[model samples]
Target chain A: MAKMNMLQAINSALAIAMEENENACVFGEDVGAFGGVFRATSGLQEKFGKDRVFNTPLVEQGILGFANGLAAQGTLAIPEIQFADYIFPAFDQIVNETAKFRFRSGNEFNVGNLVIRTPYGGGIHGGLYHSQSPEAYFAHTPGLKLVFPRNAYQAKGLLAASLESNDPVIFFEPKRLYRASVGDVPEGKYTIPLGKAEIVQQGTDITLLAWGAQVEMLEKAAEMASKDGISCEIIDLRTVAPWDVETVSQSVIKTGRLVVSQEAPLTGGFASEIAATIQDECFLHLESPIERVCGLDTPYPLAHEKEYMADHLKVYEAIKRSINY
Target chain B: MAKLLNVDNPNNTSKNDTLNLEFVDEHALAIPTFKMLDDNGELYKDAQASSMDKETAIRIYETMRFIRVFDERMLAAQRQGRVSFYMQCLGEEAAVTGSAAALEDKDMIFAQYREQAALAYRGFTLEQFMHQNFSNEKDFGKGRQMPIHYGSKGLNYSTISSPLGTQIPQAAGYAYGQKLKGDKACTICYFGEGAASEGDFHAGLNMAAVHSAPTLFFARNNGYAISTPASEQFKGDGIAVRAVGYGMKALRVDGVDVLAVYEAVKKAREFAVENNAPVLIESIAYRLAAHSSSDDPTGYREKEEEETFRANCPIERFRRYMLKQGWLDEAEDEAAKEKIKADVLSALKVAEKVAKPALEEIVTDVYEDVPLHLQKQYEQLKQHILKYPEAYPATASRIEETK
Candidate 1:
């Protein structure tokens, strides 16, 4: 097992997938030569050749639509939309067509095998446009599967599985944690099941559900809470669409109290959904109403970096609120 | 009479004494419109005209009737709120169905929003159309798309897109693939004249011309883009004129005349396959209906103006010519209409009644498999449905039934 950062792990996965499947091609602005704006797809163009891995014109819609056409015609096209916030130009392709391709064509035509690999999330000083968790927008659409990997191991495993999937996937890597999170990633063509949850730590008192950059935030909060005797059970939901209900349910049932956390806005955010589920599945088991600690309901604010993020303090606050309740 | 350009047929280099019009030159830029079966429903003394028996002519007419009837029924369904929205190609049937008829079944099509006639002509079942309109489980589209955006792999029709001209470039690229494979198939992309204004249109046409991809860029110049008429849309004569600038073959056809459209497209498809060259066809036509069910055409265009277009209806014109030829009679026309009306109505009823796709489908196609967070999100929605039964009563009822 080789220990590497999340960005390096993602790069390794892209390299391995392209090496294994001749059909697996990656295209985006600055993805080739420059590696990527974030270096997640770094060194791929040189390794795979420009024909296999290259840069495309800055038309997001064209990039995605071309990818869809290629994927439909039997190529595993993985397009990078550069940033999560900038994906709106290509939103229609993903939401209206790519997501719904299988269902819309009555399964007669399916490009269920394309991956839109994008770097998402705030916390880095990238500002409003560059740093957004637009997973909610994708989650709102029916046909799309959403993935948000936390660290190196999950990044490589989940991305490899996504590339191999016979469905269109939005593989969102947290830009903030691209270098921040590190873990041992097993080499070779390994795949993690898409809708499975990983229990990072066991706890007897409370279930802390989170993912992506927020999962790292939860770990820090959990460390802080442990000093005060709160055994926080942390569940990292690596995938967003078709998420692991069984894992979340079991954890909530065992812990009796649930605290969901995310860096996205509080209202209609990913955490709100998780908190709602706990209320339904383990309402009887709950010692409290499920509490959610999320980013404030506002456009991600600039100049208020610490105030905007659902960091350790917010996670700890939510845990306290759930415990007290 | 306007003096037409005289030049070589850009689509075909063969030296023939076809009338060289003003629009053409020795360089062969103009698109040659062919009509072996004249408007008088008489077959001209052309050696290239295919032998079309009464059966084939009747089949074509019946398909046109079916499409018109289906469009009318869908409009009614939309009015009843059984479906959300609809766009009817009421006056432009020949441009769609005729081109579809001219091609081999294996050839691919990339359509803009209004070319439902292509789907109908290609044997996309009435049930599939209804299912797509109503978004039922039986709908191959899985109740996921907005109404009228039809796609069928079996028919080789790339799904219709809402974005104007996006399919144009995509078709060119797809045709490039076909060229690379040395396949007999060419890609036919249909869009309205309004969509031709988008950059994708120029890009697609220029790319196809440069790459020598087998593609036919069919522009249905229906005279209006919602409220913006062609005069305001472009200063050029029509979309056909742009083909010359791209150094590709171009044509202008009496879009109402099904025979002209059919003959032109047949030769265009042939040229595309043989030389890997592209063709731009400007179909001169009018929109006899509102842009969509939501649009109020009376706000922009006069009722009398629309009345004039309705008078010169494509179906009516084609019907008259077909009847004059003694190929179609009153009885057959009525029978075809009655059968299509019944089929469309029955399919609509059946399709509307079918259940919507399961909620699990919402997350399934996003990846090769459902991811963890999405599973959680799915469960959360399920839980929300369970918890707040009053808010989503329909989903709650579905859940209860599933249980």
Candidate 2:
């Protein structure tokens, strides 16, 4: 095991998947010879020929639709959208066409193996245009699977699984953690089951559900709260859609308190669903109302990034409030 | 300015006829206009038709009649709240069923939302149709999809999507795969004239041309797209003209004439397989019915417009031709009509009585296995259903049975 950043893990995963399967190809705006804007698909074109890995036009809809066609024709496509906020133009293609093709066509024709990888979330001031957590928007869709990685180990595992699986996956890599977060990942090929939750730290006082960059913030908050004698159990929900509700519900029942966290708008955010589900399934087990520490219900503000977005302090406060109640 | 060259031997060409000289091989429209059977229902002496035996032609006619009756009854059912919505091909049945009849059964069909006639011709049972529209358990797609998005794996027809031209490019990609597999089967993607305005249509055609994929882009050029007329849609001759720009083969046929559509598609399919190329056929017809059960055509288009199209209905034209050929009897036609209507109504009754899809379906098929997160979501939804029993009484009561 060796410590590696999110970018290293993602790059490692791409290299492994491509080496294993000749059909796997990666394409995006600047993802070819130049690697990518963020270098996530770095060193791909040098390794695989340009036909398999190349640049596409600026049309987001074209990239997704064309990839769907390619994937349908026995190619494992991993197209990048550059950023999560700019993915709307391709939303109809991803949500309506890619997600529903298998179910709608009764599996007569399916775009079974495809991964749409892109960087998401806010920490290093990406502003409204570049730093929106758009996972919930796709989570509402039926056929597509949504996965976000909090660290390098899960990043490699989830990316590998996405490449191997016969389903379209939206792999949201947290932009800030592309270099910030690091962990020891096995050099050998591995796959973490999608829709599973991991418990980062064990505690008994309260359950803290978080994902992506927020997992780092949650760990920091849990550490801060530990000094104050509020032992918070931290659960990183790596995959948002089709979430591991059993693990979350069990934790909530044991702790008898829940605090959901995410860097998206409070209303209709993923945490809203988590809170509603916790209330419904573990209502009798709860010691207090399920509280959510989420980004403000507004466009991600430009001037006040730290205040507007949910972070370590906000999560710490939400947990304290739930405990005090 | 680019000079136009006289290819008919410029030195010997007479000055008077030079400007209008017919070149042996000049760039002109390559689309073949077909005429296999005449208006009086007489088979043409020069042009040979498909070897469709008497039995097969009659079977095709029966399927067309079935679709006509099914559309009419479903429209009436929607008005009575038996179904929520419907789109009918009241006048353009031939364009759909005829082309479908010409194809091999193993070929895949990617359809826009309005081509129920294709499904009906391909052996989609009336009960299956009703179950899909009503979202019953017996529906193969489960109840996850909206009404009219029917898909059947048993039959190679893809589920219809509401998006205008998504299937166009998808068909190209799917056909490319079929070519790789060395399958004789090709993919047929159907869309309307309105869908042609979308960028995906152009991309699909261009890709199909570039790759030489075996695909047929069947354009149902119904006079109107929703309420937008064909005149406003393009300044070109029609969709067939655009095919030439893509450097592909093309044709235009009288969609209301079932024989014409059948012959054009059959020839086009052969051309596609032989040359490993794509063919675009524009079938010019009119929608005598409104766009959908949800649409009120009276506001945008006039009833007089519908009257003009109703006069040239495909079924009526086919029936006239069949009678002239002495292949159809008035009493036999009347009996067939009665039987189709009875069949559709009884099928609807039985299908609607069937149970809704099991609750677990909500968590299945997104992947090979339902992941842990969706399982949690399902459990949560179940708990929510239990809490609000009145909101989903049937679902709540049926949860135990589903599990």
Candidate 3:
């Protein structure tokens, strides 16, 4: 095991993918010598050579379309959209082409060998363009898998898993925790399976459900809620689409109360999907209607960023309301 | 002013500094339509003679012949309600087969449908074709795609997608990967003039040129894209000139001339690999049949226009060329067509009788593994189907047997 930040762990995972599979390639804007905008791909070009790790022209749609083709050739094509916000330009390619490559062609052709990695969520003063949590948009796509990592350890394992899986994956890296979320990650390959949720801390009163950066917030909120003797069970739902419903529903059934949190807006957020499903699964057991602590229904704000956030304070308040009810 | 190109823009730069009213119309940038064979299947007076091997030439013609008969029979099957839908590459056989013959078998092909002949040229068997179009259990796609949306990993041909021009950028990326691997192979992306209008076309061509990717972007300017004509599709000089605009080598060729297409592609592949660059080739042709089975040509085009192109069918043009060179006999050629027609019919009969893909295949291959939600839903669906025996006739009996 080695002490590494989220960026280092992710970089390490990409290196392993390239070294393990000769067909694996990493390409995106400024990803070559510059090592990407966040330096998450730093030292990759030198280590892997410009062929496997290189820069592409600044066109998101082109990047994905090309990656889709490369994946069709059975190459492990890892294309990075610089930010999740800029992912919209390639949304048609992702949703229509990559998502449907396998199903539409039956099983003969697929972009299953493709993984799109992009930094998401807010904390830096990126205002609107860089801060939006776009997981909800991709979660709606059926043939795609969505995975996000909270810290360095997970960032390494989850990314390795996403790379190896014969399913198209969109890995949302939390830009906020690139340097902050440090941990001792194993040097080599390890995988946390897709569509499986991780239970951070077990409790009985209520379950705090979130993923990626939101999972970090839930942990802090759970800690504060413990002061009031509200034993909050925290879960990091690693996979968003085709989520770990069995684990989450089981937790909800036991706890009898749930609070889902996210960085996206309240309306039609992934939290809504969780709430609706959990209510049906554990309807008789639920003591109170599941509370949702999510961003306000607006574009991610610049000046009033804290107000727009569904931070620990907000999640703790929601936890309190659920327990009291 | 002198930073680049001795002035501002490559298009607007002039020697003298003066305000002038000028406009470059379509005529000013007139694109030369490449032609090799005349009405008698003889090379044009000024056309470059090709030193193509007899064996390669015969192989191209044979694949072209195979597709010609296969397309006609399949379209008839669609008319008879045997298959759900079918798209025929009836008139564009030479264009597809010649290009396929030009490339190494290992080179990747990203086809925008209608290039089934390319698959045939790369040794996709008649049984494989029947399996795919029949959507039987033997079909590699497992009855998932519509008929004719064929794919083969072994052949290096991408599975066909109905979406237009999406394969353009994919070829650019795949070719770049090949270039990086130091593989002498390149990628050939096929699309119609109609698909070239898609935004992916622009993005793909620009990216390929900028990144020095070795890709051959082949546009079959087949007179129509579904119901729309090439004239209505765009205002520019066909598709090849756009490659120049994107800073890549470009070519325009007669889609009916098999030898011309073969020679052009051979040189283009060389240029692409030697320089690690892309080349765009526009093959001008006419769709003798409707855009697809669903389309009606009488609604938009006249019989006179159809007759004009039908008179120049790619299969006939190539056969005549083969006969002129004494490479084929008229009697043997006619006999071969008869055998091909019978073989296709026999394959169709076999394909029609094969069982449909297993019901479980429906929920499979969408992901590497089905998650809990899908498993539950599938279980629920199975129970529902098993319960309602009479209503779900096709599936009930199978589920009952499994239970």
User: lDDT winner among the candidates?
Assistant: 3
lDDT of 3 by residue, A262-291 (tens): 999777899999999999899999999899
Poorest 10 consecutive residues by lDDT, candidate 2 chain A: A298-307
- List the candidate 1 regions with Cα displacement exceeding 4 Å: A1-325, B1-53
Cα lDDT of all candidates, in order? 0.80, 0.81, 0.85
| Model 3 agreement with the true structure over B104-177: per-residue lDDT tens digits | 99899999889999999999999999998877788887765667888999999998765567799999999999
Off by over 4 Å in 3: A1-325, B1-21
Q: Write the per-residue lDDT of candidate 2 for residues A205-296, one digit (tens) a residue.
A: 99998888888888988998999999889999987878999999999989999989989877788899999888999999999999887775
Candidate 1 C-alpha lDDT tens digits along A1-325 = 8889998898888889888888789997657665666677777878889798876654578788999999998888999977788787687888888988889788999887699999888876444455678888888888788998888888899999898888789999888888878888876769998988899999999999888888988899899899999999999998888789999999888999888888887678877777777788888998988878776554553333344567676678678878887
- Cα RMSD for candidates in order: 18.6, 18.6, 20.6
Number of clashing pairs per prediction, in order: 39, 3, 0
TM-score each candidate: 0.55, 0.57, 0.57
DockQ class, candidate 1: incorrect
For candidate 1, write residues B1-403 as lDDT tens digits. Answer: 7654554564544575656565554445444444545444555676256545576567678788888998898899889988878899888998788888888888999998888888887888888888888766676766555678789999998976555567889999999999999888899999887778666888999999999999999999888776556765666667888887898988788787787788788889999999899998888889888888866775556899988878777777778768887877899678878888888888888887787766565556656888786677567556545655664443566777776
Q: Candidate 2 residues B42-131, lDDT tens each?
A: 666876755665766786788888888888898998899877568888888988988998899988899987788888888888888989
Candidate 2 colliding pairs: A242-B373, A242-B374, A243-B373
